[model samples]
Target: MKLTILGSQSPYNTTGHNCPGFFIQDNQTRLMLDCGSGSHSLLNYPNDLQNLSIILTHLHRDHYNDIYNLQYSSFVFHNQKRIEKPINIFLPSTPAKIYEDILSEQNSFAKYQIIDENSSFKIGNMNISFCPTDHPVETYSIKVQNGNRTIVYTSDSSFSAKNRLVEFAKGADLLICESSLLKEHGFPEINSHLTSEQAGIIAKEAGVKGLILNHFWPEEPVQKYVDEAKKVFQNVIPAIEGLTINIPSIEKELDERS
Candidate 1:
């Protein structure tokens, strides 16, 4: 499995990098996770847009802003490529206004699929499950499992004392968590954002093999975030645009063992 960071900045990018968007692919399947600001412009392969599945964690502007661009781009690409199949999009329903506009339009660009209440779905070889997050709006933390590799992405969530989010990410090979708050600043839990320390705690409790901290404030020192997270979880990385990560497959491990 491969994970590419298309954008990692938060709310709005202070840096040149786009907002929170990711491109994840395995051998046969390609999935776009969160089409945020500048994602359409930052797309490395316009042809890949022809056939892809997109999952939007919530309707937050920073998270879904690029959908409009994608719609236009896909439509144009479809005309050029004669692509008849619409892209599959999975998103929450409660921000009814957003989905209404997306689904109301008669376009061949996207097919909207509603994800709610313990929804589990399959796209090619990947099995996806959702857990309700502690965000202000309806948000979901996604878990994807393929073979022995598991990835848990906490789209946007606040600190929870109960540790339900930790349980959701249990045993993941990679935990892609949002670290929107600085430990020095002391964020409000009600705001639905995680501090670097909180992110580390979750990664540690979840027992993930690797931790990628993203959705961060662009102006802050990257090393500060890493240092804070490392206090709890050792294998931590700060996400930057164009960063590519590869998850080793179970077959490789078995081959080495033999």
Candidate 2:
């Protein structure tokens, strides 16, 4: 399995940095975890569109705005006979107006699938599940597993004792968590976002192998987030655009032992 960071900037995009978007691929499947603004420019367009599936954590513009770009691209590809199938899109069915607007177009070239915390699905070799997050919107944190390796992505969310994030991320090989605020910026838990320290605490409690802090404010230094998270969890890094992390599959080892 390989995880690629397409964008990590939050709220809005900046020079060279886009909003939250990630691309994960394992074996035959190619999944776009989110399609935030400016992320479409990073994709391979018609080429990558083949066998592509996308999941939006919520209806926030920063998390899903580029979906329109993708929808347009899909339509063009289908018209040109460059692709035969519509892309599969998984998203929450809330904020009724936004959901209705997204699906209102009859000519759209994407297959929509409504998902919630109770949803679990498989795409190729990867199994995926979701857990509700502490965001104002109907957001969800995603978990994906393949060949005993697990990855959890915590979308925009706040920290709370009642949050199911730690349990959802428990024992994950990689925890891609949002570090949207700095501790000095005031109490983050009271807001709808997590601080760098909060992200670290979650990583420590979850016992994850590594933590990648993302969804940063454009003005802050990425190093700060990394440094703060390291205070709690040593094995932590800041998410960088275009960075690709390769997760080796353990299936071969199991096959050899068998």
Candidate 3:
């Protein structure tokens, strides 16, 4: 499978990047994870808009605002036959207003699938599962598996209840974590986000093969986040816009050598 960082900025876009967004693709599936601010503009044609499946971890504006733009483009572009069908969106079912709003536009641009704390589903060659994270609203951390290779994304969560978080991400091939702040900045008031240190701790405890740190605060230096995470986990990759990573398959590697 391949992972693409469409955007990595935190609450909003910075000088060089957009807000949180990701594009993942394997042989048979293409999925978009989180459509935050500036994602729509970054997600232009021929590169990311064909037969896409979307997963919105929560309805927070920074994680979902670009969905409106996606909906609009889907309608306009499909009318011109640029796309064959409506996009599929798997999203949380709480915060009734957000769920309802998405459902209201289902027939037009998207097909909605309700995701909860314990929801599991399949798409193409991937097996996906959800775990409720420590966030104010109904938020979920997602795990995607294709055979033995697995990727976990910690959308937006606090450091308070990390046991479940660690277990959910255990043994993942890559952990796409949200490090919203530096350690010295202190935690968010609502305890809804993690600092770089906390993100690295989860990655280390979970024993993931690699860590891709993202969802950064715009004002801070990106290297600072990477440096903090590297202190705990050696294989740390900073999430940069348009950066693509291909997961190495052990079986494939063996076959090639033989």
Candidate 4:
């Protein structure tokens, strides 16, 4: 499978960066992880509108604002007969107001399904599952598996000893984790997000093959987040907008070859 960073900024979009969004594709499936602000403009449009599935971690504006744009695109495309079916969207059902708003506005262009920690489904060759995360709202961290390769996306979440995230993400080929702040920033006591170091700890404890850090605070230097994560886990990759990463790192590929 392939994971692409559509945008990595957090809270809001900035001068050259957009809010959190990611694109994942394998041979038979096309899935979008989030649709944050400014991410709509980066989508492949008519092409992506067809046979696409979306999953939202929570109702945070920065994580789902672009979904409105996608709704419009789906509407137009279906009207034009460019696509025969509505796009599938899987999202948390809590924070009732936001969920109701989305349901009310949803036309026949997109099919919305409620997802929780117990949710498990398949799309093409990919097997997808969810686990609740340490976030204020009903947030979930997602796991996608195709054959023996697995990828885990830890959406907005804070560090918690009781969080099932490490087990949910264990042995993943790639862990796309949110690192919303630098360690020096001193995460707020009522934390709902992870620092780069915290993200590294999760990666190390989970024993994931590789780590991709995302959900950046726009003001901080990207390299600083990477540097902090590398302290605990050396195989750290900073999430860059428009960069696509192949699962099963080159190391694994070499090992298989050997």
Q: Rank the models by lDDT, top first.
A: 2, 4, 3, 1
lDDT of 4 by residue, 1-258 (tens): 777788888888876688888898887578999889987777786887778999998999999998888888898889999987788988898899998888787554999999988899998889999988888898989899998999899988878732488999989888889999886997674377888988998999999888889898888889999899988988887877887776756346423422
Q: Candidate order by TM-score, highest to lowest?
A: 2, 4, 1, 3
Candidate 1 lDDT over residue span 41-144, tens digit each = 65655656755889999999899988887777677778787556777888898788988887776654778889985799888889999888887899988898
Distance from true location, Cα of 44 in model 3, Å: 4.3
Please write out the lDDT profile of model 3 over residues 1-258, one tens digit for every residue. Answer: 887788898788866688888888887578988998887675657435676889999989889988888887787778788788778888887889987887787435667888887788888888989888888898989999999889899999988758898999999988889998887786564367888888889999999877888998888888999888878877777788877677765334323322
Each candidate structure's TM-score, on Cα atoms with residue i matched to residue i, is 0.91, 0.93, 0.91, 0.93
With a 3 Å backbone cut-off (N, CA, C), the pairs that clash in candidate 3 are none
Which stretches in model 4 have alpha-carbon errors above 4 Å?
106-108, 161-163, 188-190, 248-258
The local lDDT score (0 to 100) that residue 85 gets in candidate 3 is 74
Error of 3 at 40 (Å): 2.8
Candidate 4 global TM-score: 0.93
TM match of model 2 to true structure = 0.93
Q: Where in model 3 is the C-alpha error above 4 Å?
A: 44-47, 188-190, 249-258
Q: For each candidate, what is the lDDT?
A: 0.80, 0.86, 0.82, 0.84
Candidate 2 ranges beyond 4 A from true positions: 161-163, 249-258
Q: How would you encode candidate 2's per-residue C-alpha lDDT over 1-258 as one tens digit per residue?
A: 888888888889987898999999876579999888887778877888888999999999999999988988898899999988789999999998998888876666899999998999998899999999878889999999998899899998878732489999999988889999988887735678888888999989998888888999999999888888778887777777887778663233222321
